[model samples]
Target: MEPKININNSTHFSWLSCWPQWTGYAAALWSLLYGLLGLYWFLGGNGFPFGKNDSRAEMMGSFLSNLNVDVGGPVIAIAGLVGTVVAIAMKMTWGSRFHRAIFLSYAWIMSVTLIFIVPDSRIVQNFAYLFLLHFDLLDWRVINQVFCIVGGFIWGASAIAYFRLTQNACGNCGRNDATEGSSAKATAKWGKWFTYFAVIMALPYGIVRWAWALGIPLGTNDSSMVGNEDNVRVEAILGGLCIGGGVLTLGLIQRWGVIFPWWCFFLAGKQIPIWFVMVPAMLMSTIITITGLKLSPQIIFMMVNGSITNENWGQFVPFLFWLPWGISLGIAILAYYLKRRGRCKHCGKL
Candidate 1:
């Protein structure tokens, strides 16, 4: 039997409709939580959502250390405040043309800020996962993580819902631009440039990693150049994947992006679902952004006061690329989103 296409099912994703305004509710609730956390941080409270410093906190501190502690606290608090407002907007503006735009904007903020805090919280409770634990306990950490996972899922859900709603209302482009002044041509043009930039930025990181894997020690002192026996193999593989993702980004602009390439065995030539591309791309982009933010402080510290050695600088090569990579990837994702939302190519009537 052939796998099905998501035409009729687009508008009425059972999960999305099952709970109307769930996204709104979820966004609002998390907003309040972030507000509280922000207050705590602003007040110099040692505590974060789940617990205190661990690897993730250390990671953030690695960045945080560069700034005056006095400034950092307020910065964090403000991030929370921003999240709160965005979340409220997400819920309050359900039917407006701005709904998805708000969602996307908030998503970018959360991708960096939320992912930053959640990782710290998650690392503390992550061990619970090893025991096959349900983690149903009513502690702040568990509650926070639960909400976080739900929030992440909601981001994807909102994207899907927005696409469906658009497809159903405007069968063609005529009605779309009427409501929102954004044009398909403009969105596509920006998307193409962004994808090119993303691909360009990702190349250096991948190459740097691959170089390390080859035992070339592209950017590190011998003492710091520790690697597992198979480190070379693993790093090489990772580098390839990085380059691969970059190349695949071209699909965002090319026709093959909308319809699967003929080479895709089972999915060949099918009209690709927007969510299929956007959600994962968004997820990866978030992760990349998080990784960069987590490590940026450490990198900065070394350059400023830690160490200025050539080898030490070399180690930072891959991480350095993450800056541009993250920004480019985010833009590319937004572009693809605009393209698809502007005019969905496939959706059967319910």
Candidate 2:
């Protein structure tokens, strides 16, 4: 049968199609929840309705403290709204291409902003203080729950759509007819290998996180020695694991193969799909690696000043892990899938 092509005027590649339905669904949900939470923060309101840290006044005060009322305030609010709306719109069948562009733009801008803000010692300290002071004044728990649920729903819906779009036997890039030879075999072979690579890279990290959460003390150290010695160790180990794993995975993707382990036969000169799988994997891994590297110093400072103690450091932890990790992971998976669909069936090349 001839391959198919996606002719929906969607210039942007559908990278999320590589993984199972659940991956896209989960990612979409995470993006939406994070986007909405960011929106709430920008709007000078607490998204969490019932948590101790869910105070509008405190959130607003924090915003004002870090951002100038005239420039920063308006920019944040407008950006937040636009970003949230665009993210939601991307799930729709008609405007997904445009919406995806907008969503990516927003994410990039916010990521840059976070990079600048997180490094500033003064900003980190003040933000932490503000959050602690107003912790109990707002209703954050409910708001957070709502965001989670809504975000999950969006993710689920978008994931379904993405899956349907990719599963079409039609090839991407409108290359329905092509030569048949070694290329076909190569394409099929590489596709499976790439999928395996992604799974292998992601599995260990997930396992480590799960073990850490379960109090396994699996050699995790705290990059920011904020509280008890034990807590510091735990955080450092986990943080280090994430940062290190991401870096190693990225390096492997870049190198394509290595020559150390005797058990591995394809360790020397395996030319994987560089454009599709390798590039996207590297991009995703870079996000996490860079964020971890950048945030290390700031987290250390916070720990030293007692601004973020063991008991209260949980608040910042999510931001530290989720932002870069989630974004990168989503992009990586999406890119892989898109590349898979776009590959030349006969040549096995993208």
Candidate 3:
């Protein structure tokens, strides 16, 4: 018998029905629990999760450090209560156009605030530390941020599923035969451009790190600092990862993204599962964006305070592009998703 290759891998996720309210309910529960935690803090609870009042204020970014816990506690409590109500409403699956618009807006706002506003670059750095097996640097603040981030992703996913259900589309694929047309083709036309832009954005960071590793000191006059063993090792790692990530990013528009290349003996010519590419791309884009956002304020402050001078400009400047790099990568991933998503077998939607 010939070896069987699963080319129809895209249809397997069709089991995910659009009508399920479990995710929405889960979001509501998360909001409720977090709200109660805020209520505790508002009532003079000893463990306020973040800000200067927190014992880990130094590890918290400047933006977080400046936050007044008293004000934040009440605000968070109110937001959580409101989010809980909105999340529950989303599960109802029926509303007027105006009401739907308002609910959708609220859901996205909640997602963005929790994911982007509540956390900073330290969360990404903390994960890198985990990869390095440096568990000592992991702290409660990182855990709290990760929790908030998870809630944000849950809310966002719930909102999307709700939207698809209300629109009479496949919950798993966000499509119907009627809605299918040239959208994927259009995405393909533009996707490559965004991929290129993302690669370009990553280049400066990679180049700087590689140069540092080679003792070129591209951004500064300090030759001695550039050649240090620790500096070289760290820069090499960062540079290699940056370059490798860029290479992987090209697969979004490359042929190999869909099918295994000839280079792999047994896997060659086999269909690559959609989720294999999507899950990692989604995660990478999110992590990159969060890290960039977290670093922006601090980087700007450094530039303003003259803390970043010609003596060490190379170390700090290339990172300034990270925000755009992550954003472009995210856009590229969206394009790839749009291009690759197939007909939903369960709903029979294309």
Candidate 4:
């Protein structure tokens, strides 16, 4: 009951149908990278990760501090080697439950762990500034995380796709079954919910930000920060844009989101590229949200408990939207991939 895919990257390859077949290889590659890094860490060196693996910011360093480097290095290397093997084994047509779990574990751990490596200056700038303004700086701190996210997304999404495709017997594409249509409908339904939740999560954050720009002190402990007068116009502009953009994000599940309106002129009615929507949504929202959470403990304490503290209540404003924004967008991205599973532009298949 596998649906037929009508797309090809070359005479020998039909990527649309063959994409999932490569997830295992991708997972193995990531595992190998981790293994090598582990080996490097074992060498009493600091660059286990590209930049800023210092004691303060390094992930899980505090807990692992007591473990001698001599021992830790070997342990890490062993795990990497085992992971590489396990990851490689799953490259088969159907991955086991254990392998699926492994994929999810590494995907989450590896990708999220990279967020901790972001610098202090980047942390203080706030999420919006980092995402909107400082985005152009081509630093490896950002690059590493991007790789982490991409690797995780690929392994995880591909595994799910493989399961769904095989489960539906979609591998037997010759037989016409209700699987494709039913699965698409289900995926789309989830997509709608994801988009709806994403809108709700983002709407409040944008509204509060907009309010801040208008000098309507939302939570800043310092009134003068609002009185800067310079921010009044600047923040207002940013707020308006955030409001508009948040609304536009809902278009991910809407008709206009998929096909541009007539006003778009030449691009109107054409299917928008998935990466156009997904790349920004995933990277920007993720980094912003993590920046909100992954920074220093003092800041985190204030954000979470600021609402209760008599002083500096405004510190809590960022928290109100940060988590929801991250979760909402993450789920929304999943829904997007689910709905558009087989519709690859390069392969020209749907």
The C-alpha lDDT values of all candidates are: 0.58, 0.42, 0.78, 0.56
Candidate 3: pairs in clash = none
Return whichever of 1 and 3 wins on lDDT: 3
Sorted on lDDT, best first, the list reads 3, 1, 4, 2
Write one digit per residue (lDDT tens) for candidate 2, span 1-350. Answer: 21122334333435443332234334444654455555565567543232234333233222223333344434544655554554444333224455555554554444444333322222222323343353442233323333433443344444444433433423323232343222434444454444345434444444444445555534334533344445545544554554555554443323343223344476535444435454545444434433444455556677788877655555444434534453455444444444344454322444
Q: Which residue pairs in candidate 4 collide?
A: 2-170, 219-314
The TM-score measured for candidate 3 stands at 0.87
lDDT of each residue in 161-248, candidate 3, tens digit only: 7777667665666665577665788899789999999988878878887888888878878776577787787777778777888998
List TM-score per model, in order.
0.62, 0.31, 0.87, 0.68
The TM-score that candidate 2 achieves is: 0.31
- For model 4, how does the per-residue alpha-carbon lDDT over 229-315 read when each residue is reduced to its tens digit? 766665655566556657876877888867778999999989887767777787656655664455334455555764345445454
Which ten residues in a row are the worst by lDDT in model 4? Answer: 168-177
Displacement of residue 28 (Cα, Å) in model 4 is 1.8
Task: Kindly list the per-residue Cα lDDT of model 1 for residues 16-109, writing each as its tens digit.
Answer: 4333235545655665666666677667776454323322345443333234335555665666567566655554444455665666566565
Model 1, position 285: C-alpha lDDT score: 70
Top candidate when judged by TM-score against the true structure: 3
| Runs with alpha carbons beyond 4 Å of true place in candidate 2 | 1-65, 68-77, 80-236, 239-251, 254-349
- Stronger candidate by lDDT (1 vs 4): 1
